[model samples]
Target chain A: MLDAVRTARPRVQVITNPVAQGYTANMLLAIGARPSMTSSPEEIAAFIAVSGSLLVNLGILDRHRRDASLTAVEVAREMGVPWVLDPVKVDISPPRLDFARTLIGMEPDFVRANHDEFVGLGGADTGEEAVRHFAARNLTTVALSGPVDIVTDGTRIVRIANGHPLMDRVTAMGCAGTAVAAAFRAVEPDPLIAAAAALTVMGIAGEVAAAASSGPGSFAGAILDALYGLDAATILEKARLT
Target chain B: MLDAVRTARPRVQVITNPVAQGYTANMLLAIGARPSMTSSPEEIAAFIAVSGSLLVNLGILDRHRRDASLTAVEVAREMGVPWVLDPVKVDISPPRLDFARTLIGMEPDFVRANHDEFVGLGGADTGEEAVRHFAARNLTTVALSGPVDIVTDGTRIVRIANGHPLMDRVTAMGCAGTAVAAAFRAVEPDPLIAAAAALTVMGIAGEVAAAASSGPGSFAGAILDALYGLDAATILEKARLT
Candidate 1:
């Protein structure tokens, strides 16, 4: 799947996350996937139509991006583009949770989020059974990332435990991971496999980054370097997917 | 000046560059300066009032941010707060140029830009004379960044030539530099010396980062790490300000 993504070089459109915009784009580039961050409503539809998949991040929810997100989600559906919904920090904001619900009702292919975000968006928990049940109910893949990662789509499930604690120290690490998943989703048909594979690659790369890092600042950059230097041999040896 | 910034730990308010917001904030943190990225018009005045300095970046100009910028500038001026204006890529768009002109008319403390952006904002060249001329006409300092960074306030001019070429490969490097300048301006009373000192620190940090970097990806993160680890001993030895 990593090879497929690199060869395809599929363009992934991500909306919101003004804070993490550059880092997310750099992370996508590290994994050999092109990132398009067009969140403007005037030109987002065009960018979305041309992209293979879309990622709507609800972290920095604002009035202008609200309009852009609604338009983007509809355009992606109209164009048959696969999309992921990342309900970031929805637990803290009622309005953000409501907006996440709106994106959820639009039938995203996957909902990539952490445990708190997953549960906040009405999921039971980060437990495997709960994740699988949520995926079955939502009719979308549930990528619940934590100390261990679980990617499931009702019938199929994959567990990947290969990252480092340093990842949590970095801002937008999960957002960046979700973006890589969106890139994989662009080229892969199976939502479960796409999320699983992308998480595996990012997790392994993160482990490599943590080995050489002194702190979050160094870890953040080293992870991008590790992803760029990541090869098939390393991926095959380090991958913890089941 | 660096110690002053670290001791004061002044807050800098950046009004634009959603793309570079996180990196810029991280860079500010690396140097012990607090970064406040508040672009919403409703509350920007409140943020600006408490902030030590403000930076208005015209990189990703949008209708909503335009309102926020106008409001931020007015509030910053009303509060007698220092501010820097970054005319990013104004040559590419007439409307953006017009907007830059409007900000220019409002008396920014400094106009920090690249050679093209400097010329685009009506400067003749990046030469010492042109920068000085621009500074005198606008009643502000001109900080022209390039292979050699030039900072002048119509009279006191400093040229810093201590950065690595790898700095350009990293996205938002210039915008990040402008943000750092804002942090320094908060502590230093002189705009020319503030811009000069900040660029000298960042340029030296870039040189340090380049020593350990394999590519732009690594360079981007390494620069932040380098900035975090930078010290007075290294700054005294490596800075080429004249």
Candidate 2:
């Protein structure tokens, strides 16, 4: 996935939260993806037309952003562009949670979220049960991320154990994670492999970053550097799959 | 100003562009200012009511964010809270430029912008001319940030020569700079001194961060770390004011 992303240099359109916009764009740029965060309803369709993948993040939802996300997803589906959904902070807001569930009906290629958000999407505890529930309904890859990230389909489950606790301290790490899934999905055909590869890249980078960081402040920069410096050999050697 | 911010722990409300949110919030947090980016019109007034300072940035001028910024600034005025206006990217959008010009009549306590934005706000060339133009019209301090940031009122001019060129490569540095001014203004009543102090903090931190960085990626982390570790002695000894 890392080699594919570096070679293709996918152009990704991201409809994300205000809190995640800067860092997410920076993260994509560091990882060799061209990112555009155009949220205007009038302009979103046009931008998604040229994008290699789409990332829809339902965090800090508003009328305009919601409209743009809906439009972009529809266009991405029509164009056969892979998209990833991140239901960020959905548990805290009922309307946002409902909105995310509605988008789930669209059957995005990948749905990545934390344990709380995955549960909030009307799924049960334990990543296996939740991902199995979704995979049974539709051909989608479900990733329930936490201390040890979980990636699965109905038949196969992959658990990644390469992240650090310090990742939880930084803001927007989850948002950036879903974006990595979108970038990987753009080049990798299998949704399950794409989701797991994205997690592997993020987790390995987190471990490397945590080693060099004093706190979350330095961790943010270190993570980007690690991603930029990542290679296929390192990813193949460091990946912890179960 | 740094001492005041650390002691008071001011709660700053920011109505800024999507691209500036994460880093701006991080900058305020590292500087001991509690930051909030509530943009809903329904909640902007309530948030501003409790905020120590308000920062309205016209970076990505959307209707909702603009309305929230306008509402927050008005409420800030009524509540006697100092506010800073950052007319970012005014050169690109005429409607947003006009909107920023209209808000200028509201008599913001401080106006911070780059050379192009200052010129877009109907000010003349060079930081001195543009800032003096605004200062002459109203009792507002104008900050024109560049290689050597210039902060001034109608009667007095303070030049800050402590920054590095690498700061220009990082996105949202100017927005974060304006946010730092807002944080300082929350504690220091005098706008000129407050703006100068804020610029001093950012500039000196930039110099320190640049020395420790290999490129923009590490520089981003180093800047935050430097800001976190900054002291009065460092600022006094490293500040290059003319």
TM-score (all chains, Cα) for each model: 0.67, 0.67
RMSD of 1: 6.1
Best by lDDT: 1
Candidate 1 lDDT, B131-236, residue by residue in tens:
8998998899888888888888898888899999767655578889998899999998888788888899999999999898866678887898898888899999
- Model 1 chain B is weakest, by summed lDDT over 10 consecutive residues, at B88-97
What TM-score would candidate 2 get against the native?
Answer: 0.67
Write model 2 residue lDDT over A8-99, tens digit each, in one string. Answer: 99999999888988789999998999999998988887888888889999876777788888888888888888888998866655677778
* Model 1 agreement with the true structure over A16-99: per-residue lDDT tens digits: 577778888888877777676756565576567668899999888888888888998999999999999889999999999999
Per-model chain A TM: 0.97, 0.96
DockQ list for all candidates: 0.18, 0.17
